[model samples]
Structure formats: C-alpha cells, structure tokens
Target: MRSLDFPALIYILLPEVFRIIELFHFHKQVNMYESQITLVMDTICPWTYLGKKRLDEALAQFRASPSSSSISFDLQFSSYQPSPSRPETIPDRAAHALHEKHNDNEEAQKLFEEHMISLAKPLNIPIAFTGPTGNSFPAHRIIQQVQESHGPEVTNKLVDALFRLYFAEGRHPGEDDMLIEACVEAGVGEKEAKDLVGDKTKGERKTKEDIRSIGMDIDSVPTVIIEGRRRDLTLTGLKEVSEYVKAMETIKKEST
Candidate 1:
C-alpha cells in the first residue's frame, strides 16, 4: 500500500468530520422541546409590565441553565382591556381614575400609590400613574396587528415600548402618536406603522374577540399561561422569577 501523507490525509478526513459535527447539531436541535408562553395583558397596566419584566428574567435564567439545551420557548402576548367602558380617548389622568375608583379617598389613593411604588422598586420598574387613562383599544389593535404580521418577538418589543411610553414617559397609551412611535421602535417601517395606525378599523374585531375570550376566563390582567407537553400551566398575577423558573423546570421534566 502507498504511504498517505499527513496533510493530505487530514484534508480528506476534514470534510467527513465537519459533516458529522453538523449532523450532530442538527439532530440536537430537532429533538429539543418547544414550550409556548402566552401572556394576557393590556398595554397600560403597570402590573402587567412588571409581570413581563419578571417573566423575561425567569426565561433568561432558564435559558442559561443546563435544561435549556433540551427546550425552546415561544413567547406571545394576548390583548385584554381592564376598563372596556372607558372612551377611546379620556381626558382624565390615570391618577384621577385610580382615585375615583377608590371613591376619591386621598388616604386610600396615597396608600395604593405607595404600595405600587414599593412593588415596583424591587423590579426596577418606574411605576408612574401620571398618564391619561383611556380605553386602550388603539394600543391593543396595533399590538394585535403587529403580532399577526411580525410575530411574537416584534409584538413583545412593541408592547414594551408602549409600556415605557405610558409608565415612564406619562404618554397616553391610546393615542395614534404613541402607537406609531412604539411600532417604529419595534422595527416596523414608519409608513407601515402609519398605515396600521391610520386604519381605525384594523384589528378591531379581533381585538374585541380576544378581549372577550380572555375576559371570560380571567377577570385580571397579567395572567400567564404556559402550554407544556402534558398539560397547560396557568400563572395568575405577578410572580417571582424563581416561581417562573420552577414552572419551566416542571415543564422540562415532563418533557422527558
């Protein structure tokens, strides 16, 4: 037999070695489990924003863990309106509405505000009830349209932008300007966003249907539903990051 040169031998074997490595990675990816996390929330709800931030933290923790290699996640947001009776554009500030809800008791309002601030402090979210309170239909419509067209990632970004605009910047959530700005921030073209915002009737029926569907099951915002392999896990209200991580671990264990 003729002697094989070392360099030529390596060159001949390198293609097969790379092919095997590629196959291994492809197989691993194919075998990973997929979990869907659906968040039912409104754009203007401060608690919902906190919930989203916490859930994101939990997901990051889980992704960094060893179990993440076996699983993938799909995050989605569903629309819900806490005050469906309010007009699309309201003149009263959110603080006034909150105070009115508590029968205009200044003490009660102060206590509630303090409670919100305390809860938000740990999460690093600036909870300001300074913006105008309205129907939230416009924001919901824009989010629904984005979700349909751009998928969950973009929709989540848009939701975050809207939250920041309202809670941190004290802007009206239902205003066209806010919606358009959020869309642009979420990577949608300004013209497309304008078109989406200009069409007043776009996503109205679907938003209403989603609101009705979600409302029938839960009367609260920030309800999270995780669709797992065996059964669905529902987490209501704001939860600790560890709690969410535990839920994901349970799902991952079941996946095995």
Candidate 2:
C-alpha cells in the first residue's frame, strides 16, 4: 500500500513512453524515402519487369526534384511464383507451347504476343520466348536464398538480371547456367548460389507457403503488389507505366 503511488506512476509513464515510441515509428514510416518501395515480383512475369522499370523511372523523376533530390528509396524484391508446381519444360518453350495451345485461334496467341512486344518496345528490349518454360519453383527457391544471405540490394540486382535474361533475352531462366550467371552478375558467391538452388531451405519453404496461403492462383506473369494501408494492392498482368505511377502516388498519400 505504501508503494502504491510509485507503482501507479510507473504504469502511467510506461504507456506514455509507448505512445511516444509509436509516434516516432509513425513519423519514420511517413518520411521513409529510398527504402520505402518494395517490389514483390515473379521471375516469369513480363509485366512485373516492365512495371518495375517504369516505377524506377518515376522514382528517378521524384528524386530529381530539387526538394526531394537527395531522397533515395529502398527497393526491396520479394518472391512470387506465377506458375508454381508447373513442369520445368513448359517455361523453356513458353512461346511454342502457348502458341500451340492457342492454335485454333491464331489471334489469341498473337494478341498476347503483340502486348508483350509493345511493352518491350519502350524499353528497347525484344522478347521471342523461344526456349523452355520450366517450373520456376527451383529458381525462386534460389532467389529466396540470395535475398536471405546477400541482402535486398543483391536480391534486387539478381532479380533484374533474371528478368532481363528471361523476358528480354528470352532465355530459359530456370536453367542452372543462366541462374548462376545472374547470381554472379549480382556479385553473389557463385558456388554458394549454385549449391543452394534446390536445397529446400526454410526461406524457400516459407515463400512457397506464403504464396499458397494467400490463395493466389496466378495464370500469367507480372503481378505487382503495392503495399497499402488495409492490405496489398495487386496489379495483375501487363499494365501501363502510368498506372504504376498513379498507384505510387496513392501509396504516398495514404502514408501521409
């Protein structure tokens, strides 16, 4: 009873301290610049690659402004498998496979190809999808390892390289040689990267589990998720850069 006052004051002050800490965190989130943008993408998605390039351009423009010139953003790359558990050979020959599937209606395939070509035109990249369309699970598993061990910057670089290899160059990204080349390009330890490719590590398992937990049945590539107040805002399929720009602005405003 004699120490009741002190105990009461301690309890009161603890909540106040927590409030201050919460306020500090809120402010920090609002002002975050260079490290704010997180790109959750899949290697197979063409539009994710295109959307990211466009988003990066917009961010560059933002950074160029006199007031925000010094501000940099944190670009974090996350994993998503558009076609999980699919056959490895399918991706290697995506164009042929898809074309054959749509053989009854040539326009069905041509229309899709036309969209891909248009997206690549602005970036001065060409895609023929001549090779394999293998399962991305193994490759995505490798990506998880890179992100865990190397860091976000390394992951981002590797992701960009993979995107270029698969979408622009139309190579089989699921191939070991191609993936190793991408890892090396990102400055990752080549031997370590290769070893971890199909290791069934915790991170890889978690990524795959998360994708399924969300119940996302992705039929196509380039699904972009914009983290919003309520949950994630998803952009499915190939979208114009302008749409991404608008989405970014909305996220910024929401943060405010």
Candidate 3:
C-alpha cells in the first residue's frame, strides 16, 4: 500500500515530456534555419495581405542573391488585433470600413476601396471586398495555435490561407466554419483546431503583452520584425519590397 506503481506514473507524465521535446525540436529547427522573423498581423486586414506578398518578394530576392543563399529563413507569426472587439456579424465590408473605425464619411469609404484595389493589382489578388468583414479574434487564435503546436512553416501556411480566404477569396475569417476549413488546409488537426478557435483570448493576449513589453503597442497590422544577434528592425503596414530587403540584409549582417 505504501509504494506507488512506477510504470503507471510514467505514462501519466509522458505527455509533459513530449511537450518538452516538441518545444526543443521547434527551436532546433529555428536555429537550423538561422533567421528569426516575426510577423504580427490580423487576418481580415487588407494591408497585411499586401504585406505578406511584399515580404515574399523580398525573401525571394534575398535568397536568390549569390551571397545569401546559405542563410535559411524561419518566419514566426505573432497575433495583433487593432480592433478585436468589433461585431462578428457584419454583413458588408465597405460598411465595416466606414462604421467600425473609420469616420462615417462617403469619401473616406471610396478612398479606402480605391487604395485596396491598387494594392491588389500588383499581386493579382482578386479582392473585391464584396462580402462581410468579420471580427479577427478567431483567426488570430488559429494562427497562434498552429505556431505553438506545430511550427513556423505550418503556421505560415495557416496565415497564408487566412489572408487568401479573407482578401483574395470571398470568405470572412470570423466564421467558425471557414476558420476550421483554413486550419485543415494548413495541415492542422481539424478536430483540435475547432477547439482552439472556440477558445477566445488564448494567443493574442500574449502578443499584446509582447508588443507592450517593447514599449510600443500594436496600432496596426502586418508589423514585421527581424531580430538579429546584434540588432533588430521593425516595419509596419505595406512597406516597399526594397525596405524589406534592407531589413533582411541588416539582420544577416548583424548575424554574421
């Protein structure tokens, strides 16, 4: 009666051991890849979509350069909700743009749309803003869940899907079903993903705290940061491709 079952106790503690291994493996992969890039973005954000495309272009150029081919890239994602508490059931996007945060002026709406269209053209993003613009809190949770459970590559896939679904394709990220579909496409477990989306404020609270810790709060989406051994660079919104290239170059130089 005094002695406990050692084998049974070992099984009970196995999951925690696996979690430790997973964390170790993820960081191992990151170190192997050599660069740590964190993108803090909202899913339903148009400018973030453009930012993603721009970042991709910059990375392609950076990698194609003869001197930098040896440097591998690891893109980590952080969540940011500029306006997390907006209504989840808005049926129109343009109206959301006009009412939710922007002033309720007709001309302001037109300019927003016009600028979006111009940005969409370069990447050939088929965005019409024809449908609803739902709340972004759920999408952030899914991205964070994948990043924490899976890895940066898997998380990048989910973030890409969310942006494509919300901006290029005609789907609102606020819908649970759409988010579940996105998770599945990103190689996330469908069942577990639903549970993640159901829980609010899990991932984004830490993102908010992270931004605050650095003495700056997130006031916008698609904020990309390159952290190096000796320096760090930050960019917000749709920065030029050359600017992104410069950021990566700075990181590489500092890393060396």
Candidate 4:
C-alpha cells in the first residue's frame, strides 16, 4: 500500500483519512463477534470445578491457534443454587453430593466420588467432597459485585478462590467471613467485600437475567453458554476438553 502524505493532501481528504483512523480504533475497542461465555454454576458443585479446568484448557488451545488469535473470548459467570429453598447452611455437603449423584446407590456413589477425584488429577486442581454444604447465594453476590467493579479477570480470580475454599479447604460457603477472606486473597479489599457480602439483590437480579439471556432454566451445575457470531452454544454437566474445543471451532466457523 502507498503511504498518504496527509500534509500535502487536500484538507477534505485529510478529514476522511482521520475519520478512517478513528473508525479503526472504535472497531478495535468493541467487536460484537467475539465469543461471550456465561458459566452458570453453584459454589458447592464439585463437577463445576472440573468443568472450569476443562474450559480453561480449551481456551488455551484456542489462544494458541493462529486463526483464533485475532478474536477474543469474553467470560462471565452467573450464580445458581442447587437447593435454593434451603437455608444458607447445611450439615453435610458430602452426603448430599453422594445422594444427588448416586441416587442412594452405594456402588455408584463410590464410583462417582472416584470420578470426581480422577477428574482433577491431570488438571492439577484439587477437589474433594468431604465438606458441609452451604448456600452459595452470598458467594454469588460477592462475585456479582466483583464482576461489576473489577471486571472479568478479577472476577475469575475470585471464582477460583471460592472453589478452592469450598473443595480443597473444606470451608462452607454459607459463612460470610470465609467468603470475605477469599475475596481479599483474590484481590478484593476486605471492607469492600464485607459491605457487599450477604447482599443478594444485585446478584439475584443479574442471575435471573443471565438465565433469561440463555433462554433456558439451568437445573444442574456446570452449565456453560457461549453466545456470539450468530451461534449460541451450551454445554451442560461434564464433558471432555475436546468437546469444548469443538464448540469453539463450531463458533469460529459460524462467525466466518
């Protein structure tokens, strides 16, 4: 391409060229075709921990691909409580998981627990089902506040911390102090987290909107919904990394 000498060019042409430069920056700042992923999950869900690892792996693969490098992946997480009606605290989350997963089958319960353990081995992310179950509503609220003020990168950190506290540390999500500590460790200030800790109005509103945005009621945990490029993708429950890879590929094709 030949260089344009703006100083020597006519004033009218210079205005047009300036306009072109402005448009370039404008488009670069906002591209609607970029993938938008919304993960709806509860903090107590063990499989969600695994699903997140797989999604990260899939995204890493996408980032490495030359063709996909030009686009961006926008991630947002929504809150979903498995037992919404229950109080913020529960006696035994481990037993709950067993019953929910195996449906009272002892052999299947063992296998399910084993599967959860095995899923985290290769990813290097730890998870265990030996903790108490608590309402994830408050944690969800904190995430919502983080997402609003700090953006997705910080929000992701908070999410990882919450999952770590729940599964690896055996901490209950119902407690506000634990959530506040996790948030501070994840980059949120102590005062900021405490102020918004148990406040669920914003989180509940946004979560309902997120569910409506996906146009479906997510009954189970670990559900992922990706929107953009004329394609809407949803993956529920456990799946291989290859599955997420394929979904991204399909989205890339539709976008083209």
Q: Compute each candidate's TM-score over C-alphas.
A: 0.92, 0.72, 0.77, 0.79
Cα lDDT tens digits, model 4, 72-166, are 68788887776666666777876775676668787887887788788899999877677677677678767877888999998988898888888
Whole-model Cα lDDT of every candidate shown, in order:
0.87, 0.69, 0.77, 0.79
The lDDT leader among the candidates is 1
For residue 16, give model 3's deviation from the true position in Å: 46
Compose the digit string of candidate 2's lDDT tens values, residues 161-226.
888888767777688788888888888887776776535564766878866754465545555666
Q: In model 4, what lDDT does residue 194 have?
A: 80
- Residue pairs with backbone overlap in model 4: none
Off by over 4 Å in 1: 1-13
Error of 4 at 6 (Å): 26
Ranking by TM-score: 1, 4, 3, 2
lDDT tens readout by residue for model 3, 1-256:
7765999889999999999999987875565437778887777777888898889889889989953743566788777766656778788887767875578988877888888888778877777677877777767666766888899878888888888888767787778888888888998888887887777667767755654543355578788988877777889778989999988887776675
Candidate 1's residue-wise lDDT over 84-117, tens digit each?
A: 8877666667556565577877788778779988
How many pairs in model 1 have backbone atoms within 3 A of each other, for residues 3 or more apart or on separate chains, i.e. clashes? 0
Please tell me which model should have the higher lDDT, number 1 or number 2: 1
**Winner of 2 and 4 under TM-score:** 4
